[model samples]
Target: MKVLVPVKRVVDYNVKVRVKADETDVDLANVKMSMNPFDEIAVEEAVRLKEKGIVTEVVAVTCGLAACQDTLRSAMAMGADRGILIESSIELQPLAVAKLLKSICEMEAPSMVICGKQAIDDDSNQTGQMLAALLDWPQATFASKVELAGDKIIVTREIDGGLETLSMALPAVVTTDLRLNEPRYATLPNIMKAKKKPLDTIAAESLGVDTAPRLKTIKVSEPPRRAGGVKVADVADLLNKLRNEAKVI
Candidate 1:
């Protein structure tokens, strides 16, 4: 079986985000970058499946600027066989991204595709579902555990109330949750080897998909800063404030 995992590059989670002075997007100047944490888990799962002899090959793919190659390399270092990059500088909406991925899926025709539940930067949990819809394939989102049996895939998902298991046929899509597995760090040797791995770059327009931005960002602003409150000396002071100034009691 061939497994395709989609990865993404985003701002490092530890970075303190700042809005651009123009208020159009986040200020990325001098910001550190890393693979989206969820995508790392997706790549790790694909690699583990290959290591266990459950899958024959693992392919990592990404869509974004050239910098996204870093994320692809990170996946390759984690044991994906090769990488495909859909190069685009403009930001793509979920639908556009799904359309591009659908094009690649048609060409690759992998047995299964895995991706993060959401990108940390955007927090838009739509790409995996949209890709599944475009491909007309079974989908298991927020999967905490995944196993293969015969031609079927069993997925344990984290739902609102608790966990739920679902079975889907081959050529399905699975979006991973946090507890799927602890992602492994790339060893020094693996990181060096990843540089020699095949990393193909393709133009987004070449896929014949509309890579246009459908949504407009009308305004961007920082969230209000939290204010520090005075500590009351006793229950009487707290009650008095709540009953008078705060008017909550």
Candidate 2:
């Protein structure tokens, strides 16, 4: 089975994000960017499947600006056999990305597709489901554990109540969660090897998928600073504060 893993490049998790002066979007000038942490888990899971001999080849793919090639290379260094970059400069919303991945799926005809549940930047956990809908394939999201048994894949995922397990046949989609597995760091040798791995770039338009934004951002601003807690003299003071200042009562 050939597994296709889609990764993304996003603002580094450690950096303090800033809104642009115009309040249009996050200010990315001179800011560090890296692979989405959830995507890292997806890549790690795909690589482990390959290492276990369940998957014959692992292909890492991304749909975004040219910078996403770097994210694809990072996946290669982690053990992907090759990389495919769907280069597009347009604002890539979830549906646009899902369309691009659907195109790739039709082209590559992979047995399975793994994706990060959500991008930390947007926190819009919609791509995987959208892709599955477009392709009409079975999907499992927020997966904490995945196992391939015979011709079926079993996924254990987290839910508000507890854990839920799902079994799907080949050619299914799975979106990874944080608890799936820890990603291995790219070793020096692997990094060097990744440089030589075949990395193919395709113009997003060439895929014939419309990369258009459907939603408009009204504004982007940082949340207001939280007010600090205040001490009270006794129960009566606390009650008074909650009933008046806090307005809870």
Candidate 3:
């Protein structure tokens, strides 16, 4: 089976975030960036499938600025055969991203596509589902486990009530959950090897799709800082405050 995995670049989770001066977006300048945590999980799952001989080839793809090439290389270091970078300086909404990915799907023609349930920065859980819809293919979202058998895919998903299993035919899309697998770090040797791997760069315009920004960010602001609480001498004092000032009791 040929597997296609889509990865993303986002601010490293450990770094402290600051809102930009204009309050339009977070400050990315001089900040350390890494692959989205959820995307890393998807890449790990895809690599495992290839390592186990279940997948014949794995291709990692990403859509973003040139800086995102680093994240794609990370995916290659993790075991993807090659990488494709769809260069786009402008931020793409979920629908636009899905459309571009659909074009890539047509070119790659892989049996399966894997992606994170959502990107960390935006937390928009729409790309995978949208891509599936555009392709008119089956989708297994929030997948905790995935198994392939005779052109069929068995997916175990985590739902609100409990786990649910479903089966879908080949040529499907699967969005991975956090518990799916532990992402491996890129070793030094693999990192060097990744530098030599083939990376295909394509412009978004070449895909013949409108790359316009569909959504507008009217405003951005920081969440209000939490207020400090006063200490109460006794339960009666607390009760008094709750009953009168706070008005809870």
Candidate 4:
């Protein structure tokens, strides 16, 4: 079976995101860019499936500017058989990306899709579900554990109430959450080999999927600085603060 994994490029997790000076968007000028952490986990899971011989091929695809090829290379280094890049000049929103992935899905015909539950940049957490809805495929979101049983895919997901297990047939979509699997660093040899792997870049417009941004960002700004905490003198003082100052009581 073939599994398609969608990876995204975003600011490295360690970086402190800064809003643009004009309050238009996050400052990307000379910012450190890397694969989305959740997407990294998804790639790791797909690679593991391939290693287990459960998946014949693991194809990594991404939709973004030319720089996103680096993200795809990272996926290939992690064991994706090949990479597909849908290059777009404009910033892609979740719905647009889902539509593009749907187009690619029609073209690739992969039996399953694995993707990050959310992108750290936006934290929208909507792509996988949107893709599943667009494709009319069974979907399991926030999957912590995934297993293959014959023609079915079993996924254990996290919920506020606890874990939820779901079983879906072939041709499904699963989104990775934290604790799914730790991503493996690409060894130097694999990193070098990834350069030689087949990577095809397609213009996003050629897919006939509208790549327009439907939502507009009114402004972007950093959150207010957190206030320092105060120490209470005793239980009475704590209760007094909670009732009078903090207002919780």
Candidate 5:
């Protein structure tokens, strides 16, 4: 069975983001870029599946500028057999990304697709579901554990209240959560091997997916600074302040 994993290139989580002076978007010039942390978990999960002999091939795909090839290379270094890059300089929203991925899915025809529950950059948490909808396949989101049995896959997902378990047929979509698996760092040898791995680049437009922005960004700005907490001398003072100064009784 072949598994497809998709990753996104974003500003490194550790880096502090700054809004551009013109309020257009986050300033990315000369900033550190890396793979989305959640997507790393997805790649790790796919690699683990391949290591367990449950999957024959793990293919990693990313859609973005030419720089996104680096993110795909990271997936290959983590044990993906090959990499596919849908090249586009423009930033794609979740829906457009799902559409492009749907096109790739039709061409690759993998047994399943693995993705991060959400990308940290957008935090939309919509691509996997959208892709599953577009593909008309079963979807398991926020999967913490996954097991393969025959033609079906059992997934344990993290929900609001507690863990929920579900079994879905093959050719499903699984989105990784935080506890899915800890991503392993690529060793020097593996990194070298990844350089030789087959990586094919395709123009996003060739997929025939409309890559237009349906939503417009009115403005991007930094959040308001939080006010400092105030201290009260006693319960009486606090009550007095709450009733009079704070106007909340």
Candidate 6:
């Protein structure tokens, strides 16, 4: 089976994101960018499947500007056979991305597709589901564990209360969650070898998908700073304050 893993480049999780002075969007001028953490788990899972001989090939795909090639290279370093980049400068919505991935799926004909449950930047959590809907495939989101059983896959998903397991037939979509697996670091030798790995870039427009924004962001701003807590003289004072000022009572 051939596995396709989709990745996204976003502001590094450790870095503090700032809103632009004009409030148009988040400032990215000098921000450090890296692959989304959840996507790393997806790549690791695919590579593990390949290592186990369950999958023959792992193809990494990313959709975005030219810079996304770097993200694809990171995946290649981790053990993907090759990469495909859908180049576009426009910000693609979840639907647009799913449509583009659908096109790539038709071309690649992978046995399964895996990606992050949600991109950190947007937290939309819609792409994988949309892609499955587009391709008319079964989907398992927030996957913590996956087992290949003959022609079917059993996935353990993280839900609100606990884990839920489901079995789906082949050619399914799986979205990885944080606890799925720890991603391995790309070694220096593998990083060097990644340069030689085949990475083909195709224009997103050539996919014939409308990469337009369905939603508009009026402005981006920092969350309000939390107010300092007050020290009460006793439980009665606390109750009084909570009942009066806080009005919880």
Error of 6 at 35 (Å): 0.3
lDDT of 4 by residue, 1-249 (tens): 999999999999999998888999998889999999999999999999889988999999999999999999999999999999999989899999999999999999999999999999999999999999999999999999999999999999999999999999989999999999999999999999999999999999999998789999999989999999999899999999999998999
Q: Candidate 2 — what's its lDDT?
A: 0.95
Q: What is the lDDT of residue 102 in candidate 6?
A: 98
lDDT against true structure, model 1: 0.95
TM-score, prediction 4: 0.96
TM-score of each: 0.95, 0.95, 0.94, 0.96, 0.94, 0.95
Model 5 pairs in collision: none
> Could you tell me which 10 consecutive residues in candidate 3 have the lowest summed lDDT?
213-222
lDDT of each: 0.95, 0.95, 0.94, 0.95, 0.95, 0.96
Using TM-score as the measure, which candidate wins? 4
lDDT of 2 by residue, 1-249 (tens): 999999999999999999999999999999999999999999999999999999999999998888888898899999999999999888899999999999999999999999999999999999999999999999999999999999999999999999999999988999999999999999999999999999999999999988889999999999999988788999999999899988999
Candidate 3, TM-score vs. the true structure?
Answer: 0.94
Q: lDDT at 162 for candidate 3?
A: 96
Model 6: how far is 51 from its true place, Å? Answer: 1.3
Best prediction by lDDT: 6
lDDT: worst 10-residue window of model 6 = 204-213
Task: State residue 244's C-alpha deviation in candidate 2, in Å.
Answer: 5.4
lDDT string for model 1 (49-119, tens) is 99999999999999999989999999999999999999999988889989999999999999999999999
Clashes of each: 0, 0, 0, 0, 0, 0
lDDT over C-alpha atoms for residue 53 of model 5: 95
